[model samples]
Structures are given as structure tokens and as C-alpha cells.
Target: MRIRATVAAVTGALALSALAVPAAQAGEAPTYRESAAAAFAAAHGTSDKAAFSTAAAAEMDITFSNFKIAQAVKVGTTNKVSTTVTYTLTHGADVDIHSEDFATGPYIYRGAFDTPDNMLFGDYAATCTDTSATTATCKGNIDVYPADGELLNAHAGTWKGGALALDYVTGDYADQGGLGTTLVQRYSKLTVNASPEPVVKGKTITVTGKLSRANWETFKYAGYTNQPVKLQFRKKDSSTYTTLKTITSNSTGELKTTVTASVDGYFRWSFAGTTTTPAVNATGDFVDVQ
Candidate 1:
């Protein structure tokens, strides 16, 4: 499946007024709802954590359900990956989801919900259209710009999903955590080449290739060492590819193998991928049998 990699940044300057963030909390990383509540306090001249503490929390009527983030995300070296986040917003009819002061968003993170070690978010706020008096379907975007420094190679792996709704009026909010999990993976690539193309039948055909994946830390593609890659073949007249054998990549992520040449056909290498990388297949290289 193809994904758009030219999208924007993962986080944007929320429309929160300058009153939202005081100089004291400028550099702090807050949870999705905490930031929204702080915006309300800053705008209302109240910088205290009262808006978020469980002791003074107001009864929230809005909640999120049916969160749908992609099962797996493949991020490459340079482009920003833009993907959609969708969920169902269920709230009391009195709650105004369309209000300018009310905002909702989706996110994925590692660690605790209130104090995650790392997180990825949809830069834009979510907009919900009412499906009923109390239910609506909402859509938003989650973008990843590798060059923006929001991710490291170690960041690729399992991530948990969450959603939040904040009402600027009462500074009350609803947050859903551990809704599901998604795999954040590096984008993989492969290549194939068969030498001495016009060899006689029964001659040895030396095939060489390499397996690599995106390294977000370096913003480059590096060899993925010690991974199994399938050496597959297909006849020139047939569309089917049969896996001839599985070869492991060397310390340099290189694959070299010898196959007995027969009829005209194509040869390629395929990687099954891992928890931190997406599967990939190289374009088939055709060889002529003399």
C-alpha cells in the first residue's frame, strides 16, 4: 500500500491564545488535554493545574470511541508521512462539539498517558460531524516529518493509541487511553542484479542484492544486517514467482548466491520485514538464456 510522504509536521501551533502558555511552562511537555486546559487557564488568567487535577475535575459529557489509526506506519528517510485518524465522538446533546473553544485530537505514544516518553500527534485538530443528537464521526491527520527530529530509529516499534476532547469553557475534558496499538516501522527497500545475463543454459548465474531500511536518526537508508531475504524466480511468460530459497544478508546487508541457469526468467529478492521495519520486494531483473 502506498502512503503520502509529503505531509506537514506532526505538531502545529494550536490556536490556543497566548494566555494558554505562561513563561513558566513554556518548555514543558504536557499531555494533549493538559495543554488544552492550560490554554484555557492562560486565556483566563489561571495558570494552576486545577483544570486537570482529578480533585477539581468537572463531569465530562464527551468521550471518544472506535478509534481507527493505521495498523502499521512506514516512515522513510526524508518525506513527512501523512495519515488519517478517525474515531467516534459520543457526547451529551448539550455539549457543543462544533464550538470554537472545544477541540478534539488523536495521538500515539509510548509509556504512560499523562507522561509519555514519546508521542506522535495530528498537528490539526479534529472536526466532528454529528451522526445523531449525541454521536458524531470525526476525522483528523497524523503527520511524521523524519527531518523534523520527532523520531529516532529506536522509536520504531509498538505504540499505543489515545484520544482527547477538551472544553475551553469549563476546562473539563475526556481522555481515552490504550484504545489499541499500532506498529511504527522504518520503510524498507531492496535491490537485485543478475550478472552474465546471456549465459548458456545450465551455467551458474551469480545473483547479488542488498536489504536496507530507513534510519530516521541519520535521515538515510542503511543496510539491515542479518535479515533473511527470499530469492525468488518467475518464468518470462508467467506472472507467478516461486521462492527458490531464503538467504540471509551479510554483515553489510549484502546477499550473493549462485543459481543454475535454465530457461529465460526473472530473479528478485524479497524481505519479510520485522517489528521495526516494513516488508519490501525489489524489481525483477530479467536474464537472457543463450
Candidate 2:
């Protein structure tokens, strides 16, 4: 992914390019890598199975999924370091012994790291969950550093079947004199799942997709309770987005909307809303509802 324009501009100049420079300077500020490693150490736990299972070790892993220097305000004169990171954890079936808690993987941390290895830290928070009976999902939130915990530097890994893979960043940082600032970053994920077939007069269509708080880490946070997931259908020849029916996914993160059209032209349907997470963009397709 392209680095944030602001960050690029700030740090770019240090390389002699015109860009925002990451707080990594010679006078002594934690490097971006150092700061991330410190946060990862505090957010994860160990899995005995991973320590021995070679296969399990390879699949169960966590990494700094996304990092953004949202903003950096001058702390004192010119010493500051602040950023938010989104960490995504992917567990393979071997490691998914607790598939139920798979979605709870991305951990977030917001804080300032100005001194050499001295990162004035905070806690990390996240939410994890498994919505499907067949597919296990879990999600959780976390904060890192002087804000809450001492996880200044540590490692995180879990065992599934057998194997050893790097799960979390491990390292240390001593705070050095530098400018201090706070920043924000936004992320968006849109998951759209549609039924294999259309709903006939005698049939029901169920399209399921989960819009978990984990889906939109970068966007503003919102809550969803039986939020509306609208489905629209328009004739193959139609020109505008027409509403066919409105329905809400049950507590199970499932949605069912029916379309009954006499003609057999392409029937388009879409799901749209943003209550708990940013709404997935509306989708369209042809279905024979005869």
C-alpha cells in the first residue's frame, strides 16, 4: 500500500525528498519498526501447541497488518511520535482449534514515542468473534505502551499443529528526545456475499456477510443492532437503482431478502448499510426470478 501522503512528505525530505519524515531521526527517537515491535509484544499470548506443532506454527501468525501516521503534533518544541496500527491475525484450520474466536485478531495502539527507547505508551484494544458455525471468527481490540501496559518489547506466537512461525514483532526501544504528536488512521473492508440463486415465488434467497467492527478499523466507530441490509432489484433493462425489498441480518450476521418479478430478465440485488462498520458498497447482478 502507498504510504500516507502526509507521512511520505514529512519523512521524504530526510531522504532528501520533500515528504513528512517518520520520527526516526539521529538525535534519537524510536524507529517505526521499533515502536511497532513494542506494541506487538504486549498484545498477544503464546500457544503451547504452536511451540511443538510444525504445521500449526506456520499457519497461526500475527503481523502489523496496517500502520498509519495519522497525525503528529509538536509535543515540546520539536519532539513527538504518535501513530495507530491495525494488526490482523490469520489462523489456519490447524490453529483454529478455537475458530470461534478467530475474528478477534486486529489489535490497535495509539501513543507517543519521543525518547530513545522510551515510548510513552498506552493500552491496545480490539474485538474478536466467530459468526459462522462452520467458519470460526473472533475479534478483539488492544492498546499499547505508556497509555496502559509495560509491553515495551516482546514476542507473540501460537501453536496449531506443528511448526514455528513469527507471530508478533519482538524488540525494544529507548525513548530519545524528539517532537511529540498524535495521529489517526482509518481503514475500510467491504464483504459482499450473495446467494447462489435468485428467490422465486416458491424460493427464498439468503445472502450472508458479516460487517464486524473489525471490518472498518480506519473509519469512525459505530454500533449495529439489527441494522437494515437493503436488497434492491431492477429489470435487466432498468437504468436506475430501484429498491426491491429491505431486510436485516439476524443476530447471527445473516440476511435474507426476496425478489418476486414476473419477467425473467436479469434481477439485480444489493446489500447496503453502515451501523457497526462501514457499509459494503451496494452490489448488482442478474437473476432469473421466474
Candidate 3:
């Protein structure tokens, strides 16, 4: 994969490129082999600041399977999000996955696989443990920093995943895309308020709330519009909640509904979530029926 322009420019100057970027940068992050990474950079061609093309790497014998990234990843406005990735690696029996000259990991990316718009790799390499003679289980990190400008709000939604196999010693590597699909979502919030704290029996009590989520580009939280949200209720002494009804948020993301007051209870708005936003539930608003 061509190192997407954003990251390629940041690391291209240094001999050792993307894979071992930190390791080569005067002791920044750890890398498997700085020299190997440099060689891989040369052989694979990292000059294109626009993208680190994946077109050139010769195919290797290693194959990845059962790849799993999170079903959905929710990132907020200004915090680091860490998630795990797991996959099964099948390679030639003679290949030693643990060899010092070898490095491998799972990465999730956006846009085209061959020339992705963006890509995310773990700060550290995936830990692979042998499960059989020709197979192993690999687990790695999918680290994201909202403050780091690596992603844009427009990038939220569906993304694909794959694995990277590197051999610094031979200056050879392989990037296997299309391993899986996952959702990269914005962090979400839901709020609730019920009025007339104390009411007479059979009185109508109104509940109001709003649904919002992080907007990466603007660095603000904005209303999440026209989404189906559930109004749930629970008795003061009860531990469980029951769904009273499902309501859709307005264009401005406002929610309002009325329910008959029968007894003391708490009310809340719960969002089931969408591909671009995560599920959220408002804190319960309590009211008492006299």
C-alpha cells in the first residue's frame, strides 16, 4: 500500500519509512529493525508523497484469515482510542514468524485498498503465537488519536482491514487488503429531562432530550439528526428499564414526548446508534407522581 500522502511525507525523509518510522527517528517508538525498514522502503518505493503504493510488493506465501477488527470503533473529539485486532496467520511451515528480520501486523484503512485515502497501524507490532505447525494467532493494536489530525469526520463510517507482511532482510513485503470491514464512528451523547418533578396521578409528564456526536472537522459536538431513539422508563425501586416507545429525533436532533404519570419513575432517551455514530443513552430524569 502506498503510504497515504499524509503519513508518507512525515516519514519519507528518514531512511526507514512507515513500518519502523518511530524506531528510526532518534529513539522515538520501538521498531523491529530500522535497517530492514529502510530497505523495505527503498524496494517498495516511498518517494510518492501522495501515496505509498502497494502495487509493487511481490506476493509472499503468508496468508491471513479470520481477521477481526472491532464491529464498530467510536472516537471522540480529543482523546486517544485503543482497540484490539485479531487474525489467524497461515504461512509456510519453514517460515519463522518470530525471526528478527520479519515484521507483521494488521491494519484498518479507508478508501481504496491499493491506494487508501488513510490507514491506521498499531503503535506496536502484533503479537503472534503459534497455534499449529503452519498457523498462528495474531493480535495487535488499532490506536487512534483524535487530536492528531489523522482522521476527518467525513472519514467516519465503513472501512476495510488487512494484514502486512514485511521482511527487512530481503527488502520484500506484502500487504493483503480486504481482510474485513468495520465501522469507524464518532463518539455520541444523549441527554434527557423530564418536567413537573412531582405530579398528580394520571397527569401528563413531558420528557425532552437531544442526541449529539463528535464532529472531527469542526472540533465540536453537533446534533445527530433524524435518528430513531427509544424512550425508556424504570421505577424508582426497580433495577430494570422498559422501553416505553421509539421516537425519531427532529432535524435539529431534539426529542420530546409525553407519558402518563402513574408512579415515581425515571425516564431516559436511548439511541440505538448508526453506522457513523455510536449508541448512547441519556442519564435518567426522575419524576414522582403524587
Candidate 4:
């Protein structure tokens, strides 16, 4: 990425001219060469500033271990994902991890480093336990809701975990400095089944399904219980699905609901996922109304 406008200008000038000039005497008036030199200095000065910021951020030693999220986060769903972070701050001596100077919080950030846009998907304040003079363990819950306007929702896939160094902020503004680690985000899966095919018109049809999400610790899919799910239906030839009612999952993440058969249509389930898991929509189950 371009560091600054002055850097770009100096770069172009360097490409056009290869000659080098000595610094002008103190009594001599400034010339075009001095202007070019100033531009070059401005460009390197910006780089030095960035390097200093990075070094300062590095001083706040942060690490993530045993960081676990119960399930995969679904898009558009508000999931409360739990996290555990360990950190240590070294500034000459061991700095207090709990000090107000450090804005130590758990967050999910986008993987791209090309630009400083909406890199943060979810950020949550954490409660830390001091483990040593320079180290601490923090635990907290992050509420992740990736809606249509959210950048994370635009890209449905894995997101990495990290910690934000809010301590670098001054007044209302703060440079975004955080340490990112290798942690993969999980995605949720939902399924639906409609029974009593070829039912008479106006007859009650039973709809059942399950809501399960990926478990990073176990590397398996498990039922997500006590969560709300929506039952939607669409006519056979219709492209849109309308919500019929809301249902909750049982202890096993099993879903059951009943709807009256009106016409040949498809039945499905849609889950607005939580912070930990991404949102999911089940495939439609078609039923022919006799």
C-alpha cells in the first residue's frame, strides 16, 4: 500500500533523476534539489513512524493458548463465543497486564493485511487473572453478529483470532495495533426434514430438523441446543421462502414444528447464527399436497 502522497511523489522523482547533490550551505537559498530531498525525507519519516508503532505494540507481549469457542459462528446470528487469552507486557520491567494503560481485549479480525478497513469482526472486554508479575490469563465472551452490512458477512469463511492493543489510543483516536495468532473460525450447519408427504390439503404436516455446529476442540460437529430457529416455506414454483414460525432446539439440538399443508411447497429452516458460529440455511424439503 502507498504510505503517503509525498512518498509517491519522491518515488516518481527518483525514477526520473539518478544524479545526487550535496546538501546546500546554511546561507544558500533552498532550491528544487532541496525540495526533492525534503520529499524523500518525508517518505522515510513516515516509514520510521510505522516501525516505531510496530515496535511499541511488540512490547505488549500477548499470546493465545487453549482459546476455545463452543461452535462455529454463522452469519447474521448473534453467538456468544467464549475465549481465553494469555498475555505479558514487558516495558523495561514487567508491566501490569491489568493496568488501564493496556486495552487488552479479545477480538476476531479479518486475515487481509493489505488495508486498514473493517478488520475487526468482533471485540469483547475480558476479565483477566494475574498468573505472574508479567503474565495473566483472560476470559470473556464475544458477541458476534455478522449482518448484511458487516464486512465479515460479505465473505463467508474462516476468521482469525487476535488481541487489540487499545492502550495505544489517545483521546478518541487510537492507532490499530494488535497481535494476531493462528486460530481458525468455525461455521455452523443446519438441516430440515418434512414428513407425511402427499398429505391432504389443510392437513397438519410435521417438520423436524437439527442444528449442529463445528467443535474446534473435538474436530467434530455437535448439536447446538437452546437456540432459536425459524421455519420457512415456499411454494414449489416460487423462489422466495417466507417464515411460518419460530422454534427452539431441544437438549440435543433437535427441532420440531407443525404447519398446515396448503399447496405443493418446500419446507426449510433458517438460523441467524451467533458470535461463535456462522449463520446457516437448511435445504428445502418438498411436500406434495394432494
Off by over 4 Å in 2: 1-225, 264-276
Alpha-carbon lDDT of model 2: 0.31
For each candidate, the alpha-carbon lDDT, in order, equals: 0.74, 0.31, 0.74, 0.53
TM-score of 4: 0.42
Please list the residue runs of candidate 1 whose C-alpha ends up more than 4 Å from where it truly belongs after superposition: 1-57
lDDT-sorted candidate list, best first? 1, 3, 4, 2
The model with the greater TM-score, 1 or 3, is 1
Clash totals for all candidate models: 1, 82, 6, 17
Model 1 scores a TM of 0.82
Ten contiguous residues with the weakest lDDT in model 2:
155-164
lDDT of 1 by residue, 1-290 (tens): 11111111123321222322233345654444345435333322333445544432446677778989888989998887877889998998777888877788777776555445466666567888889999999998676777766677887899888777776556666767788788989999899999788889999999999999888888989999999999999999999999999999999899999999998999999898898999999999999998
* Each prediction's TM-score versus the true structure: 0.82, 0.32, 0.80, 0.42
Q: Model 4, range 71-115, lDDT digits (tens) per residue?
A: 344332333333444433322244445555444444454443322
Report how far off residue 243 is in candidate 4 (Å): 0.5
Give the distance in Å from residue 149's predicted Cα in candidate 3 to where it truly belongs.
1.6
Off by over 4 Å in 4: 1-176, 179-185
